[model samples]
Structures are given as structure tokens and as C-alpha cells.
Target chain A: MPGLEDLYREIILDHYRNPRNRGELESPPALRAEGFNPLCGDEVVIYLAMGGDVITDLKIAGQGCSISQSSASMMSAAVKGKTLAQARSTIRAFRAMMSLHGQALDGHGDGASGGGGTGAVGPEEDERTGAEVAAAEGVSLGDLEALQGVVKFPVRIKCATLSWHTLAQALDEAEKGAGPD
Target chain B: MALNDFGPPLDVARIKKDFPILDRVVHGKRLVYLDSASSAQKPLPVLDAMQRYYETTHANVHRGVYQIAQEATELYEGARAKVAAFIGAAAPAEVVFTKNATEAVNLVAYTWGRANLGTTDAMVTSEIEHHANFVPWLQLHQEKGTELRFLPLGEDGTLDLDQLDQLLDGAKLLAVTAASNVLGTLPPVRLLADAAHAAGALVLVDGAQYVPHLPTDVREMGADFVAFTGHKMLGPTGIGALWGRRELLESMPPFLTGGEMIRDVRLDGFTTNDVPWKFEAGTPPIAEAVGLGAAVDYLNGLGMSAVRAHEQALTAYAMRALKERYGDDISIHGPPPGSERAGIVSFAYKDVHAHDLSQVLDQAGVCVRAGHHCAKPLMRRLGVTATARASFSVYNDEADVDVLVDAIGQADALFG
Candidate 1:
């Protein structure tokens, strides 16, 4: 079984302590979308500045747990300069990583990052985690790979996915030329 | 885990054995279930009663013409009688079966609320009500133009009844919860009902959290309508009761009209059935009612007073234990010491979100609910987005509370 170290990687904690793009955008040029996870009252309001097909800038405004808050922090950093299609694929791949099939160990990623609490399934687990990280948007998930442990806890998947869903909504609103209403 | 630490004189181990789920392991640890406020674990008697009902007696009631059908009808009505007696209702005819407490509230809102309350009339409720009770009244007020009044919740998690009379002005109905699922605060339903009566308003008590934990007598409460669910009281799902005054139920039109809720059906129109059946439409939850009857029998056997005392000891120990262990790192939300409360402990940890706390706790096999608890208005009033809740049941003892404390400490360390 993967230890608790997998879920609480230092990179995830660093992101939680210092989130990127944490604020609101003006409503005129940017579209705002609000997302809610009723399970734990984790809410996110994503403000997007879209210049044609690219997301020029974004801000994260909400309060939640480490998985949610840090995920929002990493999400804002990852999608700031990506095109609309890339962001959508990242959301789908992140959802795939969070999906549970068989009972598996809980961990963030491989031993290469820093932690040394790997057990019997170290290589196989890291390889699988690496595959998930590599597959998300065809780019290294970096800090986002720390959330691989979330699949072991089904109830917290909503926390890890709230920000991405909200970003998707913001993109939807940005395309429609309407407010987040 | 060796000895019962919740208190003396109660058979805590034997009671734990009655619930089959307690013996199961979760995530390689003994399941320390503290989410009873969401739904209590059912015992063997309730499960057996349901299975027996299906195996021996399964038929459409009130219209069959066989020995087994009569036996099924007898068992169904017998369950209703048991429910009526369990809550001290005036008669068996006064109890109406619905899907759950939420449905019971909807029945009153649609049948009584829409027909009588409008314009100058108002429906007064409190901020502490579950959405099951709050949303229906809010919808009525919006659709019918009725004024809506809400009693405020104090900082200490109790209702501010100082201005209750003033809030009741022009209100035709006062619907409120008997207990808070989040704060575990037990409001004075009898007092509230008396004041609402003096202001010429009928009272509807949402007993979803009360009937399962406390000794309930609707007449003693002086509320005209009492709603509660069976699953919260160790019965199966799909069964709940709405006990209204016979006269009040008679005056209101049937909420649902169908096979069982009607007396006779003609070409153009149909006459409704009797008081209880008038509210019950189509095939009711017969097997679930049997399970509820067995649950009532089980509670009666254990004695409601004993059950209440056991939970009181457990909750008090939990509150003191968490505070003594964590000090200011944790804040338990509820009434002050010496005040009567249910076994629910809603708490918040310093600088940690409820979702995170719940996630870390689940790693150690501690089950708790982390969210608004379906009471968003009250959550807003409390000024917190959400709270982590640990609710006790008859099967829980101090061991469970100890496990919660250790798990929370682990979570605190991880966050630090």
C-alpha cells in the first residue's frame, strides 16, 4: 500500500501555501464562472481573460481543503497560457487519473521527486503515476501528479476536480460572450 | 477498544453486536462510525422484519381478497399503529406514510401551505432548519407572495428566541426543526409551538433529528404536524411518517391522488380516502414499514430514556475529550456545557478546511460528514463555509470518540 506521503507531497503543500494567480479579474473583458462542491462547501470562482483561442490570464478565488485549494493553485498556473483545446484535454486527462478501477496503493508519483517512503510497489506505482502525469495534456503534471492518491479516497475526488470543472465553465462563458450568470 | 468507556450501566458491547456493520473492517481498521446523524446503522431485527415481510407476506394492501392479502394488510396497518404509538399520536389514522421526512414536509407545503397561506399570511421558520424544511417554505412564499420570517441563530448555536413572538407576527404557519443536525442543539419545540399558537399560527415540527435520538411525544410537543424518517431511527430507507391532527389532515386536500389514496373513482372525479390513506398514494412502502415497526420495538426494548442517556454521556465525553486534547486548535460548535444537546459534534480546526479534515480522518477509518450538512442557511449564519460533523448513535461508545481524537491529531500534524 502507498503511504500517506504520496498524497501530501511537498510540492502540493508548497502550492497550497503559495497559490498562483489568486485574485479576481475585471468583468468587462474577462468572463467569470463560479463552481461549487456541495460535499464540503468548496467553492471556486475562476475569472478568465481570453485573447482569441488562448487563455491570456486567469485568477483563482475560493476557499477549500489542500487538495482543492492546491489543485486550484496548480490549475491556474498550468492553464494560464494554454489554448482552449489544451486546457480541455488536461481536464479530461486529470479526470482519467482520478478515476478508480481496482483497489490500488495511495501515492503522488515516483521516487525521483524526493520522498523515500516507497514500499513493495515503488517502481510499478511510480511508473503508473508517471503514465498518468505524462498523459495529462501531454505535459508533465509536475505538482498535479501529487493528487494521484486521491483516487484511493473516492469522496475527495470532487475536491481535486472542482477547480478544473470551474475553469471549463469559464472557458464556456468566454466562448459564449456572456457573463457567468 | 477493550472496555466500554462511554459510561456505566449500558450494555454497549451487546448493542454494538446488534449492528452487523460494526464488526466489519474499513481500510484495515475497525470502522469507527460517527455519521449516525446522516443515517443510523440498522440492526438485525429491522433487517429480518423486512426480509420476513417480503418472504411471507407480499401483496397489494387494501384491495386484495385472500388470506395472505388480509395478513399483509393487517401487518401494514399494524405497522402504522406501532408508528402512531411510538410517537404518542392520537390515533393510528393520524399517521401518513411518505418516502422520507423531506416528502412529509412537501406534503404539508403542497396540501396545507398552498391552499391556505398567501398575501398577508406568512410562514415563519428559523435559519437552522434543514433544506427539507426551509426550501419548501421559501418556495411557498415566493409563489404565493406570502411573507417569510426567519428566527436568527445566536453565536452559541442556539436560536435567539427573544424576538420569536415578534417574528411570528402575521405568520399563519411556523415550521421548525426539533433539533439541529450540525450543532446538536435541541430547540424548545413545546415553547415555540405555544407561542406560535398564541399568534394564531399552526406549528409543524421537523423531527428528523429528534425522533431518532430523543423521546418524542407529538402531543406533549403541542405541534400540529410532526415529520420524521425511519432510516434515522435504525429502520430501512423509503419509510417516513407525517402525523397531523385528524381535523387538519381532513381539511387539506390530498397531496397525491391514486389507487390507495382514493375512496371511489367515477368518470369525472373521485372522492379521497380516509385521513391517513388520503395522504398516502399508490402502493406504499409496506416492507419498509415492517422494518420500522421492528425498529420501534428494538428502541422500546432498549428504552428511549436509556438511549438518550447513553448518547448524552458519549457526547459530553467527546466534547470534553477533544477540547482537553487539542485546546484552541479545535473549536466544538454547539451549546455551552450543562445545556441539553444531541450527540452530534460539529467542529472546525484551525487553518484546516472541513474537507481536508474529513479526508485525513477517513485514512484512519473515522467516518464523519464534512459539508454544509444540507443546512446552507444555517452554515451562512454560522459564518463558516462548512463544518466537520461527528454524530453518535446507540451503538457508539467512548472508544469511537477516542479514535476520532487520535485521527484528528494525526490530521493536525500532517497539516502542520
Candidate 2:
């Protein structure tokens, strides 16, 4: 049987026990967004400092189960100092990596600089594009990639995605130049 | 059955068989239903009674003069008698059927609040009331400018009645729950009633949670009005009763007027029907009432005292087993062991989201409720947005608790 050792990896547990970047930024240059999972009492507040097209800094603070808190910790570390375009691309790559059937990217391109991509593709084609994009971008998702195990436990998916959703909302707000309270 | 015979040490297996739905599967696993505080599964007798009523004596009650209508009316009124008797009301005429307990509480708020409460009048309630009980009074407060006071809950989830004397002063009404749906804390109803009465305030008991597991006598509790739903007590949905003192019901004006609730209607004005019917307007849940009567019979046959004892044992066992396994990691809400509490257990496991916990339990075929439980104020008071709750009934046993504990153990492994 799968155990906590498999899901709550040492790094994940460490983050939960002693989380980094776990407080609100004072008068943040970027927008702040809050996300809550009503069913589980999981809550997260994302703070982003944006400079033009780039995310200069990112921080997340909240209280929730280990999956949610650790996921937020990892997300804060991964998305900091990345551009808006780069952040969106990384989200797509991360989603693809978590796919149970090892499916490929659908609409997103294979780490190409510009937008124009193929209309439709098979599952294998999508996987190839996802892998090619990760390699080309040299995006080191690192321990953040361990969240692929979360898909197996469908319940924990919400926890893993809590920070990502908040971050997405915060980025959207930052793009609009409106602070999300 | 004798009262002594129906005391503690109930037969849980036989009780489990009485509920037909307990035998079914959900999500390809045997259903370990622990959401009875939300709504209970109906027994065969209640289902059959509803079916028989619809099949044999289906007609508009109290309006038609035909034989079937007379029979339907008899059964409907007979069900009122059963409800009145069930709650130890002084007379059957005091019981008014409503769609559900929410409607029952609203009826009292609209009727009694209009008559008794002025701008200066105040209503005292606890934070533990379900939204059904809380919202109507809140609306009353909004409309009439009545002051809404709340009794605080102690850390153990029981009401801190030490301040009841101070809180009850100048209050026009006190609406409280007999048993909290979330915490399962059985409040001091009789004492509260006495205190409220002494303070010249009426008392309304929300019996939605209590009537299922325990035997309630409204008169004995000294409550002026007691509201409960049939669905939570093994009956069909869309049926509940509000038992008020006869004089109080008679003094209060009609909440909803039209149809069978009237005596005479004219172009200029209309005269209302007598007592309970005046409160119950239009076509009521006649068949649902018959089903509730059958449920009462079913429970009476098993004996409510036995049912209460059965749930008490199950709750105690669950508390002990869960504490032994999880220790401080699992925080159990409500009264401590040996305290007077119902079967519901609201809890949170450290670092486990309630929804995730419920989903894990669901996968193991152990169903429980995971949310704020319509007690947002209580949830806020508890400092949690949501909690996973496992509520017991006559049908639940130690084995069911074992399943719940096992599921939680599995969840611990997943989130540790």
C-alpha cells in the first residue's frame, strides 16, 4: 500500500513544518489575491510584485492542511522572478506532467517563443511538446514536480492547486494593474 | 414495550436492518452513512406508509367531502395527534404541519415576532443555531429593529449558561436548539426554558437534531414552541411540525392565509380557521404527515429510549477509539466524554482538509458530512471554516465507527 512517505515527501513535510515566504508582503508593489477551499477550510493569499511583463517577486501566506501549505511554499519558490508569459507556460507544463495517462500538451506550443501552434494533436504529440517545452525553457520545476503523485489521490488535488489558483488570480489582477484583496 | 426494557444496551444490528437504505451501496462500496444530523434514512414502515397513502387514499385533505378525502383528512389529523403525543404537547390542536423545520421556525418568527416584538424587544439565541433558526430571527431583527443577542459557546462546545441571567434580561424571546447539529451538544433546555419564562420571555426549541435520537417532551421542557422536521426522524421529506402552546397559537395571527385555513371569505375580508389550521395554510403535506406518523410508530416500536441509548453507546465508543488512535491530532468538538451529548461528532484532523478527509472516507465507503454544516457563526466561533462531521443514529454501530476510524487513519497516512 502507498504510504505517507510516498505522498508527503521529506521536502514537502519540511515545508509544511517550517514554511518559507509564509507571510504577507508589506505595501507590496504587486497585487495580492486570496483563495479559499470552502469544503476543507484551506485558504491562501498570494502576493506578487510585478515589474512590467515580469514577476519580480512572489510570496504566499495561509493556513491549511500540509498538502495546501507545502504546495503554496513550492509555488512561491517556483514562480518568483519569472515573467508573466513564462509563468503561464510553466503552469501548462506542470499540468501536463501531472496527467495520469501521461498525455501531452493540447493547445500550448512546445516551448516556442511565439503563439501560432497546430490546431489538433494526439496524446503522444502533446507529451512530446510538453517535454520539449520543459527542456527548451530550462524550467527547473524540481521538487514541485513531485505533485504528480497528487493526481492519484483525487481529494488532495484541490489542496495542491490552491496556491496555483491563487497565483493565477493574482497574476491576472497584476496584468490588469488592479490589486486583488 | 416497557420503558425499562427500552433503556440502555440497545440491539444495534436489528436497528440497522430496520433502515432499508442502510443495506445499499454508494460508489460501489457498502454505505457507512454518518450524516444523520443532516437527514436520516427512512425505515420500511415509513416508506410503505407513504406508498399506501398515495395508492389507497390519495385526495385533497380537509377540502373535499368525499370518502377518500375524509380518510385522508383523518390520517393527516391522526398524524398530527401522533406528533403532538410524540412531543408531549397538551393537545393535538397545538401541532401545525409545515413544509420543513425551516418553514416552522419562519412561521413562528413571522407570527410571534409581529405580535410580541416591538422595536425595543430583543431575541436571545446561541451561536450554535442552524441557519434556519438564525436567519428568520435575523430578518425579524432587520424588519422590526429587534435586538438579536447571542449566547456564547464555551471551549467544550456547550453553551456558557452562567451568563443566562444577564442575557435573558429584557429579551422578548429565546430561540435555541435542543441539540446542536454540528457539535451534538445537548443544552440545558429545561433550565433555559425556566430562566426565559422567569424573564417574561417565550422559549422556542429547535428540535431538528434532538427529536431523532432522544425522546422529547415539550411540556416537560417548558418550551412554548418546539420545531422539528419529519425527514430527520425516519420520515419522508417536506414534512415537519411546530408544536406551540394552544393559547399562544390561538393568539398569534396566520402566517400564510388562503384555502383550507379559512372559515369564510368575502370580497372585503376573510375569517380564519381554528388553531393549528390557521397556521397551516393551503394544501399541506398530508401523505408526508402519514409517513411521519408511521415513522413515529416505527420508532415507538423500537422505543426511542432504546434508540437514544444505542446512539449514546456508539458516540462514546467512537470518541474513545478516535482519541486513542489520533490523540491531540484529532480535535473533537462538543461536550467531553460522559457529558450529555448527542451522536454527532464534529472534528478536524491536523493538516487534513475536511473535504479531502471526506473524500478519502468516501473512497472507503464511509460517508460523512464535510462543510460548515449551515452553522457558519458556530464555525467562525470554532475558528474553522469547515469541519468533517460523523453523526450517529439508531442504525449506526461500533463497526461503523471502526470504519470511520480506519478511513481517518488512511487519511492521516495520505496527508502526514
Best by lDDT: 1
Candidate 1: give the clashing pairs.
none
Q: Of the true interface contacts, what fraction does each candidate have?
A: 0.62, 0.38
| Candidate 1: tens digits of C-alpha lDDT, residues B1-416 | 22233224468899998999988887788999999999999999999988998999999898889988898899899999999999999999999999999999999999999899987788799999999999998898889888989888877788889899899987899999999998999998999999999999999999999998888899999999999999999999999999999999999999988888899899999999888999899999999998999999998888777788888879999999999999999998879534358889999888788877887888788999999999998887888889999999999999999999988877756677
User: What lDDT does each candidate get?
Assistant: 0.83, 0.81
Q: Lowest summed-lDDT stretch of 10 residues in model 1 chain B?
A: B1-10
The superposed Cα distance between candidate 1 and the true structure at residue A39, in angstroms, equals: 2.3
Report how large a share of the reference interface contacts model 1 reproduces. Answer: 0.62
C-alpha DockQ of every model: 0.38, 0.24
In model 2, which runs have C-alpha deviations exceeding 4 angstroms?
A1-22, A27-44, A48-58, A63-181, B1-9, B26-29
Candidate 2 interface RMSD, angstroms, 1 decimal: 4.1
- What global local distance difference test value does model 1 have? 0.83
Candidate 1 chain B superposition, TM-score: 0.97
lDDT of 2 at A110: 24
In terms of DockQ, which candidate is strongest? 1
Q: Which model scores highest in TM-score? A: 1
